[model samples]
Target: MRTYLEVSGGGVMRKQPYVCGLDAAVDVIDGKWKVLIIWALNHRRCRFGELRRLVPGVSEKVLAQQLRELEADGIVHRESYDVVPPKVEYSLTELGDELNTALGPLGAWGKRRMAVLEEAGQD
Candidate 1:
């Protein structure tokens, strides 16, 4: 029986045997920019420059890289239009939507923690 699943990104593929479901899930969103990218695309499809604006701190290169990784992980869909300037847009896939839903509780917890910290003058 196979114990590990295959994952690919940025033209590289590998098999990872995760100890738990959280481990597998965290692996997909390991970077700082990925979750932000997912969040930015959760509502609607966005073009590259628009994504950069929505994400605030992400550079054009990093946004493109994160989008590629998300697409490779089956969490994002990229559509291209062969217009004069060649337009492209990114949106969350079904898997990505589910992933965002799964993150709701985490977001709530973070918000609560942030509030507590603010009350304690920690931030």
Candidate 2:
């Protein structure tokens, strides 16, 4: 097993044992619904309904839970306004924008790989 160190202020804070090769940073965003939520919010700010439509097969309860977690992690911002019907919107924070930028290439790679797999299976 490999041990990884957490660095803070350019110094090693503590040593952590690697469990799955992925570090804690990846673990935080490893929730089942997190990536989906991030992908949905990538294009623009969306309301609850819009998000629901964008992410198919996610239950309302799960979506709400994921949003709360994302907001707590400082990756997403939830803004509520005082209005007749109570308008609420969700958008990615600067941190989230950075994460999304990193994920763009991964997403494209997955799409291309899937296409290759489908073509090969047709033979």
Candidate 3:
């Protein structure tokens, strides 16, 4: 186990422990919707409604919460515009783009595994 330091709201530092680099990476994207959100925003920025349509099956509330979490984690960037109807667009940060690139091999492996499972009549 290794420890990392994080600052609290009270301006105090605390130690957080993780087993390895993968553990720390997984901690940033530990939810069902986060990866999908990142994927959806990979190519372009999207408004709330656009994101909802792109990521089918996610409720508005959950999507909003997940976006907030991703923003706090520094993986997503939220830009607000001063317009008549109030415009907000979400996009991936540079860190998020790197994370997406890292996930490519995992996604390919999953595709291969799914084919194997389907051939075995298990999927």
Candidate 4:
């Protein structure tokens, strides 16, 4: 027989959907445009059209889908105005802010790696 030990922290068991930390993070930012969406909303809140403009090559349907997934994962907050010509804005939640900070070093490393790769390619 196999047994799994329940992990409880801060006096409460986390309700995380993924069993592994990396898996959980990957599950939240799985799609191609999700990380870009997170990066775009890291500093400022943006509307649907704004996100579409910021993330080039992404279609309207894909953006909407990614936003919905992010919102579901509790990484992004969606605020809708109760006015004519409806306005909706998205911003990162606390969890998302932490995620952005966590990914910053990785982003920098990727930049350095890209530069090295470019140089290597030229050789």
Best by lDDT: 3
Query: Candidate 3: which pairs clash?
Result: none
Q: Sort every candidate by TM-score, greatest first.
A: 1, 3, 4, 2
Across residues 1-123, which tens digit of lDDT does each residue of candidate 4 receive?
333433443232234556678866876787799999999998799999999989999999999878877787788999999989999999999999999898899899989999998999952
Tens digit per residue, CA lDDT, model 1, 90-110: 989999999988888888999
User: Residue 9's C-alpha lDDT in candidate 3?
Assistant: 43
Q: What residue runs in model 3 are displaced by over 4 Å at the alpha carbon?
A: 1-15
After best superposition, candidate 2 residue 80: deviation in angstroms? 0.7
* Clashes per candidate (backbone, < 3 Å): 0, 0, 0, 0
Q: Against the hidden true structure, what lDDT does model 3 obtain?
A: 0.86
Show where candidate 1 strays beyond 4 Å. 1-9, 12-15
For candidate 2, write residues 1-123 as lDDT tens digits. 777666433242434664763565574477677888898899589999999999998899989978876787678999999998999999999989888887788899989999998999942
C-alpha RMSD for every candidate: 2.6, 6.3, 3.5, 6.2
lDDT of 1 at 35: 83
Model 2 spans with C-alpha error above 4 angstroms = 1-22
- Report lDDT (Cα) of residue 36, candidate 4: 91
TM-score of 4: 0.82
Best by TM-score: 1
lDDT of 4 at 62: 90
Better of 2 and 4 by lDDT: 4
